[model samples]
Target chain A: MKARILVSFKDSVLDPQGQTVRNALHTLGYDAVQDVRQGKVFELDLSGISKAEAERLIPEIAGKVLANMVIEKYTWQILED
Target chain B: MKARILVSFKDSVLDPQGQTVRNALHTLGYDAVQDVRQGKVFELDLSGISKAEAERLIPEIAGKVLANMVIEKYTWQILED
Candidate 1:
């Protein structure tokens, strides 16, 4: 089994890194870019675990280790392949 | 229009950050986790641009600014919503 976890800052939080990227894009002539939010993606391989076990563990892992729940939110999907 | 850009290190690259996270997961008792890869995701909002223009510009933006082509690869998708 494989899983993907996306960890991103909540909309309410300020993202200076994102702002910096947006500014760089503007300077690079991509003026049409209105906003940019940067996030993290974690791809996990779980060949030893069952799908049900993976489903149950992924969110726990994402929250406890991969994300800072106070400022970031995480979503995850189990991969079929 | 909106688009998503995913930037990740190529398989040949050494991802110490990912290895660190995997170690953390192991410490947290997710022993089934075999491997982990970390990447970046950029969510972009482009209300003033047409879909065609966005398609043309996104890759240019991603390749030239968002990713280091020598070590990382990027993929993008246009969002309908």
Candidate 2:
């Protein structure tokens, strides 16, 4: 099975990288741009877990490797592929 | 209105950052970690545009400011306030 994960900083978090992207685009003359926040995407192939087990296991996976809960938050989806 | 944008490199893309994060996590002793792909998320407070207008505008926004189309792919969503 494969899963897709999205990881991001929580609301109160400071995102310098996002700011840089915003500035880069603004400098490139895309002035209509408002904000740019960046995050992570993960595609994974799993072994030894049924789809049922995957649903059960992923939250723990998020806590384990997908995110640093103290600073970031994440969401995941089991891909049909 | 607010919108969330997710940006990532295409599958054929070389993901050095992802590899670095994976190495970092491994060094930190998170061995169960597998693939660590990185992406970007954006949140924007859009003014003067209705919710409907936002939905229409975001794709262009992604194309213009959020990502470099030659190397990255992206998706976006409107946040419900």
Candidate 3:
């Protein structure tokens, strides 16, 4: 099975790296851009598992090792492989 | 209008930041994690624009100021108010 997971800070959270990017954008002349938030993308290849199993299993994986739940939230999708 | 965009290096491309994260994970005791890739996410609140217009225009925005074509690729989706 294959999965693509995206984890990010919610809108309400402050992102220092994103603020830096926004500042850089302004310097680069993209003034229309008002805000930027940075996140992590994980593309996983789990050969022995089924997509159904992955969906159930990944939340635990994400909770335990993939994301810091205090500051991050995640969503995942099963991929066609 | 609201739009969410995500930008990342292609799987074929090497990610130094991701590698760093994987190394950190190993040190923190996530031995099952083989790799990690980092990316950027943008949650845009574009007022005075229609979702349709935002979707049509974001490709140009992403291409011009959001991501470097040589190193990154991105996808965007319209959001409910």
lDDT of 1 at A61: 91
**Model 1 scores what on Cα lDDT?**
0.91
- RMSD over all Cα atoms, model 3: 3.4
Reference-based lDDT, each prediction: 0.91, 0.75, 0.72
Query: Chain A alone, TM-score for each of the models?
Result: 0.94, 0.90, 0.89
Mind giving the per-residue lDDT tens digits that candidate 1 earns over B18-58? 99998988898889998999999999988777788888999
- Measured against the true structure, the TM-scores of the candidates, in listed sequence, are 0.96, 0.71, 0.74
Residue B3 lDDT (model 3) = 69
Arrange candidates, best DockQ first.
1, 2, 3
**What are the per-residue Cα lDDT tens digits for candidate 1 across A1-81?**
789898999999998999999999888888999999999999998877778888889999998889999999998999775
Clashing pairs in 1: none
Please give the lDDT score at residue A51 for candidate 3: 64
* lDDT score, candidate 3: 0.72
Ranked candidates (TM-score, high to low): 1, 3, 2
Better of 1 and 3 by lDDT: 1
Runs of candidate 1 exceeding 4 Å displacement: none
**Candidate 2 lDDT by residue in tens digits, A1-81:** 677777888868988887887788668755555776676677665556578877876676677866899999888998863
Runs in model 2 with CA error above 4 Å? A20-36, B19-36
Model 2: share of true interface contacts reproduced: 0.49
Residue lDDT tens for model 2, B1-79 = 6777878898799889878867866686545456666777677656665777778778887887678999999888888
